[model samples]
Target: MDDLRTIIDKTLKQYLNAKQTPFKDNQLANYFRREPKQYIESYIKKTGFHFNYDVKSSVGNGRWAIIPWIVLFDTDISNSATNGIYIAYLFAEDMSKVYLSLMQGWTYYYNEFGTKIGQIKINAALNYWRNSLNLTSSTFSTQDIHLIDPSKRYDTSLPRGYELGNIMSIKYDAGQLPTNQKMEDDLSLMIQSLEELKSKLISTKDIDLSNKYVLSRTNIIKNHKRTPTKRDYDQQS
Candidate 1:
């Protein structure tokens, strides 16, 4: 059995490397970057928002490969607040499948001595850490979770999925370091899903973003209206 580090390295390489047989000459390769941090920074530059990788594999944990990251859509996020949102890819037990999740932080605080306050005070301003509420497509359908509803309170419990937050996701099943069409298709799905999620997040932040895809569902809907029936055409004539 391969360790988590080796498996992840191989999986990502097969999924993105141009020299690899399956992904060669594929447009999907353009979206993937071998260096995850640089890739993330490139994405941030392209979209003009803060995106940072929050988790990665450690030498001790051989069975798990989980990489979670935050998208700082709310630039005004309080420095001391342990509250934010995240998106991540979590490897399954056997490392054959990955679960993509979007989550929100539920934070906790403690009381500490504050000379400025002259006494021990609950440091609500100082973030301790956060436990997330799963907000991915696993909790809601794809159509439902793309954009944030301005009127809906995400922190409240009205809608099932929105009770935590909105999210988008796609599963990537690259079997035992697969290097074939299955891997290609999976990567495509993952990339497209990430792009959609990023676009929606930017839009939710009220920032105007132009989607890179020239021919998307939105464009199709805008360019092609429903055709009227022959009877309607005759009547108009």
Candidate 2:
């Protein structure tokens, strides 16, 4: 309920203050997957779409990552980051910057086509989606992101794959994050394009809306208020 700007600034500081030792058992690392992540969910709940999300300080197991991330997925499209298109907030290895990117599930393409050909398919999907969407934000970049550090060797290809998956993105630097109003406005703008894309998928593929298997944030709001109209009830079922 506090201002989102305040929360984001605080979270960024927290990340920086503890960046050097983001072990799995570290409390600061755990905070990324817990409270801050929930706050982000609460803020974005105004969008009305349901999303699945996760934050990682490590590649997996005990392997700490240089580029940590928080990601949100619209299951109506795909449930996991490994196999579908989704949105993510990627933090730089040095904590100097973060990127809000519309990215694809690269491992899926990599598995199906090998890295060489998978990259080609990823580019194809990127072009198709960018050309089809109605996004009006000129601020978003489709070019590149600064997630992988060139100086350090990485054990996993996740970071490189993430870089290759970028379809569009907006960058925010440390100490230069916009005001709460601006941040919310930007998120809402991106969500509009995402929602429209979702609608297109449903209509074109004849995908049943009921197959989404998730609760809309609007429904969550109604349920929390303990007041729901008959129409709302009907929609839920």
Candidate 3:
């Protein structure tokens, strides 16, 4: 029964003592991969909640990457939705804070540079969830979540993309770590909100159509309007 605070503490510890860079750190990489799985499985068992969820962890690029991330997708809606939305739990390096985000989908924009271009679609989805759950008091932060289109910057290497539908993030200072009780309370709130959002999404009749239109619009721009990169061709092949 690993608590959420324990998970955050361990991540901080690993980040501080990490000898290897973000990409090459096998120890840190394994922590993100293993911890999320254990925590999610244990949470499901303990809470007696039947959630069809999928867990994924990644140590992006390997060289300069410091933050390893794990995502938990309520596959019930993710698999069926247009944007392939999911909940992401990211451990950042600067503040050693945890960022909770509702990710719309995985796509990149490369008009000049590259970015995630689905603000309208993602906003619609956000409104749908927020309104359905009556999350009027729930505040969403784009502090850690990059809301601007990165393509405007024209920096090819600037890592951007991952449309954040809604984000609720927390930061821990240099010496301050969240207490177990605090982390549990935060996690509880997040989980409850997600559960309600998932239920509403699954039960909604026009959800499929809405998602379809969003996906189609995105594809029209990415596939037809934008020039295909070598990676795209390779993927098609």
Q: Is candidate 1 or candidate 3 better by TM-score?
A: 3
Residues 1-237, candidate 3, lDDT per residue (tens digit)?
456666666776766456455456466666766777787777767767677777766555444344456677677666421245666665554434556665555332133223344444444445444545644223444444542344455332322444344434444433476676665555556666667665544233344443544343342344333333232222322
Order the candidates by lDDT, highest first. Answer: 2, 3, 1
Say which prediction, candidate 2 or candidate 3, comes out ahead on TM-score. Answer: 2
RMSD of each: 19.6, 12.2, 8.0
Q: For residues 122-236, write the lDDT of model 2, one tens digit per residue.
A: 6766666677788649888888787867777887788888888887888989899998788777766766666666664533222222212112211222212222123342354
Clashes per candidate, residues 3 or more apart or on different chains: 0, 0, 1
**Candidate 1 — worst ten consecutive residues by lDDT sum?**
122-131
Superposed Cα deviation of residue 140, candidate 1 (Å)? 7.3
Off by over 4 Å in 3: 16-25, 61-66, 79-83, 93-96, 106-117, 135-159, 167-174, 202-208, 212-237
The model with the greatest TM-score is: 2
Model 3 local distance difference test score:
0.52
Tens digit per residue, CA lDDT, model 1, 1-237: 332234444544443233333433443232322233344344445545433333322211121112212222223221211233444444332334444434332231111112222111111111111111122233223322222235545442222222232233444555444343443344334334444444433233321111111112121222222221223222322
**What TM-score do all the candidates reach, one by one?**
0.30, 0.74, 0.63
Model 2, stretches more than 4 Å misplaced?
A: 1-8, 14-19, 22-24, 47-63, 202-237
Q: What lDDT does candidate 3 reach at residue 65?
A: 41
Give me the overall lDDT of model 2.
0.63
Q: Positional deviation of 8 in candidate 3, in angstroms?
A: 1.9
Query: lDDT: which candidate is best?
Result: 2
